[model samples]
Target chain A: MTDTSDLRSPTPDPYLSMDLLRFTTAGSVDDGKSTLIGRLLYDSKSIFEDQLEAMETSSKARGDENVNLALLTDGLKAEREQGITIDVAYRYFATPRRKFIIADTPGHIQYTRNMVTGASTANLAILLIDARKGVIEQTCRHAFIADLLRIQHIVVCVNKMDLVDWSEEVYQNIVKSFREFSSRLQNIVEVTFIPASALIGDNIVDKSTNMPWYQGPTLLYHLESVYVGADENHVEARFPVQWVIRPHSDEWHDFRGFAGRVAGGVFKPGDEVQVMPSGFTSKIKAIYSMDEKLEEAFAPMSCTMTLEDEIDISRGDMIVKPNSPPEPSQDIEAMICWFSSGKTLSGRGKFLLRHTSKEVKAMVREVKYKVNINTLHKIEDDLEFKLNDIGRITLRTSAPINADAYKKNRITGSFILIDEHTNETVAAGMIL
Target chain B: MNYTITHLKQLESEAIYILRETAAQFEKPVMLFSGGKDSIVMAHLAKKAFWPAKVPFPLMHVDTGHNFPETMEYRDAFIKEMGAKLVIGSVQDAIDAGKIKEESGARASRNGLQTYVLLETLEEGGYDAAMGGGRRDEEKARAKERFFSHRNEFGEWDPKNQRPELWNVFNGRKHFGEHFRVFPLSNWTEMDVWQYIMAEEIPLPSLYFSHERDCIIRDGVIMAVTDCLELLPEDVPEKMTVRFRTIGDATCTGANLSTAATLEDIIAEVAAARQTERGTRADDKRSETAMEDRKKAGYF
Candidate 1:
């Protein structure tokens, strides 16, 4: 009994007080994105001894100038052999301030799908730029995708400062150029700039003494302190029914609860809500978060809600505040990013569209225009939406889907197009 | 007012969402239970995902026949307590049927052979989705794993051709004769699992706690002295107070010298420990790409 005391009145757990930050990194192999991530993990003491030992052994065998940090992320055999990252890899690290999940995405033009996939879940994006080359085509392309994904925060890391002798002029030039370019983008809300050398370990986790002239929060500091709570839409109440809980057992015979994660706003018992697609009104009876009754629930919290009335609701139906109900329509206009290389996006192409918990058959009605990712210009001439091409298209669904504009709500506005025949995710769309 | 929740709560919500998605998407699904802390947490989350109702899927265990007796006892009691169905895939039966051959020598382990039995069990049971406790933070290859990992008709994973998983919307669509290995714990680390276990008061096997046991030191690893392991020339048996960081095949799972009798002590030990949790996993030490290779061939 005395030994079990630790499990009972345990002092405050360090993890319970910490928050979480999910950010994605965008850059080419030459931009030292891997090294920057490695330095952050290494300096923060997240890299364990066994992993470091394995990395050292692999580095020696490969005959590299510094234990190639790229080996830390390139997990697959093909990626290691070819010295490139073919897919998005997730890495975790934690500080006293917050726990961080890094979506390490490759920078090649062909792998734009990976970046888009990584950025889709991230609250922030880290754009890496080489000091020698201030701002290039690759930089603009990465920034455009991040903005298109509606990533609220962007941290421009000006790396490889050791090669330029920690020049403040080069960092400022890159920052100015990036600011000028990002001003034209639509959805990015905040941007931060930092000067550092990933290989030499400057300004990543610790404050660098080398750059006495530069003054700002370190990369890790900024990440730990950034305000991403406002990123979630807390004004519009929306809950998409994912699954219905029905217990046939005698103990819970009459149990019928609608389960889902809150996509936007706050919900509480006694709130009036309207069921979508079949306009029905009901009052929230109770909210349960894993058997524990909650006073209130908000975005990103998975819970079960019981309505006052027995409404015919299933997985595809949504419950929202009656005043702010989304417009239910069969026609949807969206910005599409084609992901499948085997199949190209063409007009009148039919695919399965998954938005929220609803699966509907949709047909591409028209390809309005394609955007050249490099120049961030509307390329109306080339309507051919090939792999990794961003374009605007009109889609008509087999059924009416109640959706909000992407700018208002990320969860309700975004959708994915699945190839009907191959079952591959062909494109990601943001409702315009 | 602060609108943010703690990291633990956030991770719990995310995992619960994935578990609910699995229950809704697949006709037949199962949870792979190993009686380890990770699996214990996963099962606990599953119970919460559909409360007032029993877990929709059965809990499957691929018995290597080289497990600690304590593990078998704990697994049976856990299943009975959860009021869930249990399914076991026996590796020994596969070996007897000539489906897989047993390895020879002192370092022989049935870890790789369990994959054959697992795949066969899934085929026979007609389960289209198998939810595992595999975490991305555990190994290098797993770092690239998706929440809904697709496997072909041959039950092989194509890492390069994995579908893009974006946001909380998990694409679980698969063709007939194909299945997906869903990992609701993909974002969790070993520390996160332990912390959640402590917070949730999830019951685990007694093997995780410190106790006196017969052990042998091999290549700087404290291998438990079990009947299934063949003694090498350098292997010497001794009584030591040791605990396992991970629970796997008894012949391959290594123990660490510790006195962490409670969850609190274990958490403190893990925080100060210098090595990864899988560092003591003798199976992963077989080769550089051991886990990756095993996963490609359909290992959970």
Candidate 2:
């Protein structure tokens, strides 16, 4: 058994025993995004001295009045030199309550694929809108992508309030426009608007003295306190076995366990379950998280489960409850965000599809329609999905894959398309 | 009791997920162990990942031939403890075989030379995936590195043309000669690693804890006095209570004077410390794009 005796202290340290919150940042290219992220990190006291010193030097070299907070997040050489956010740069910070992983995604129209990739795993998203510009096309597009990705929380930070003299009229105007457009967005459960200045550091980490009009939680406070525990699908049980652990040792000779992360729902020690493909009926014998026997294992918990029956199972096999099992089918209808650069996804293209822990040969069966991201209108007759294009498509797999609708359970329903030729992740698909 | 996992437990689960993925996806995989805390944590996770079953993949140490004696001792004990097979890719062997030239004088280091040997080892071992204990929080350039970093046949990393790794799914597709340098610890920060070590009671080398050791100051950084580094006339060796933040080639690895004797002490030290963990490393201070330049040329 793996030793975990030292982990149990006399008293639980809240700071060390806290959870994590992963959030994504989306905004217009020049919406002071880097500055806002920089502000959050700096005010949160996560920025190290060396990084801050480097940012200061870069800001001096760039001849900016204030240290360019954006410089901290713009890690790549090309991105720094070009003064643009190209790729998604992940930033880390922690408070007494929670640890945050900020996915600083690019906001350009061409980088919609990057935005989608960032939001794919995020629980929350921060949509930055320039106070002067109000709710523009970029704001709507970010909100649409956030909604499409089913991000639970959206924080609308109406930034650059310093330029507008912290006027409530401009802030309310932007908030009103955002709410008007955002009301149409689906799946975004909570929407929050805060007026702040990224440059002068208002309403980010500390309470803003400038904004007596704003009375909501600070961006950092909300991030730490946001309820993400209920974001997963707790109704249907799903566990895709990623590995099988068999000791083959004398001490524990007959230890055959199916190891995987719980994709959805709760699994206890005596739950009646059925293995996919084989349809072998079994009852859960024991659930273990590295020697610690658990009463139950829920979504996202990596655990090993031993069954009452010795059924043959592999990496791609899934273990689900007898009730409301995910539909198994060879044909899959999905919305794919094409990511292949310089390579257009044509109809009838063959690719390797990976779902949960399943990987099978799949071919693009049909290209149904392309939806214009800017207008959110479905375009028919246009079947081609080029680089950074999101379109509806149908696929046929070589073998049957068990999966749920992407909206119902993001873990089991979502998959990535791999180009066997180039071996690159060509697209991210969400089962419809 | 809260069944929900904490950040440290969550990180452990995520690391295990990546390890299992590497084991399942690749034909031949190896864990890059260096006797460092990060690699030690990686090895421990590998144990939990395939509990009851011995670690499926072997451990490969890209020996710089400039290691602290304690590192080798810890490595041998760990290998024995885990019953893991050890494959050493020696820089000294390459130097002796004339496969690569050795650097001389103050700037000479086997630290950069390990890259070539690492690539050679991968090709020779027929390894399609080499798991490293690298974390993105260590360096700026590493922040953009994907969990499954693809390298061409020539062992080159194309930063601009990297794949987008989404969700828990990792695409480990490769050609005949190409392989992947997967990082199971990509998202973990320094505090998280120490916190995890404290939580799991993972054993590390004594060198990590503060001890009285002979050291010499170079570039305002205290480096342990070892055979790997030839001291200059002005360099004076001093006995001080120093511990290493990162374990690598002793020649370039700087030591910080501290009394962090226990895991709890280390965690407190890490939390209160202002500079980045890599701030003590002299190898990365070579240039602004030192890590980037080396990464492009296939450095883990």
- Put down candidate 2 lDDT per residue, A319-401, tens digits, no spaces: 99988788999999999899988688878999999998889999998899988888888988777888888889999999999
Which residue pairs show collisions in model 1? none
Residues B133-223, candidate 1: write the lDDT tens digits. Answer: 9999999999999999999998999998999988777788889999999999999888788878887788789999999988989988999
Candidate 1 lDDT, A234-291, residue by residue in tens: 9888999999999998988888999999998889999999999899999999999767
Give interface RMSD, per candidate. 3.2, 2.3
Error of 1 at B83 (Å): 0.5
The candidate scoring highest on lDDT is 1
Per-model fnat list: 0.72, 0.63
Q: Pairing residues by index, what is the TM-score of model 1?
A: 0.98
lDDT per residue for candidate 2 within B1-300, as digits (tens), equals: 233567777788899999999999899999999999999999999999888789999999999999999999999999999999999999999999999999899758888899999999988999999999999888888989899999999999988888998888898889999999999998999989987887777788999998998998889789899887899999889899988899899898999999999877787788888888888788888877789899999999
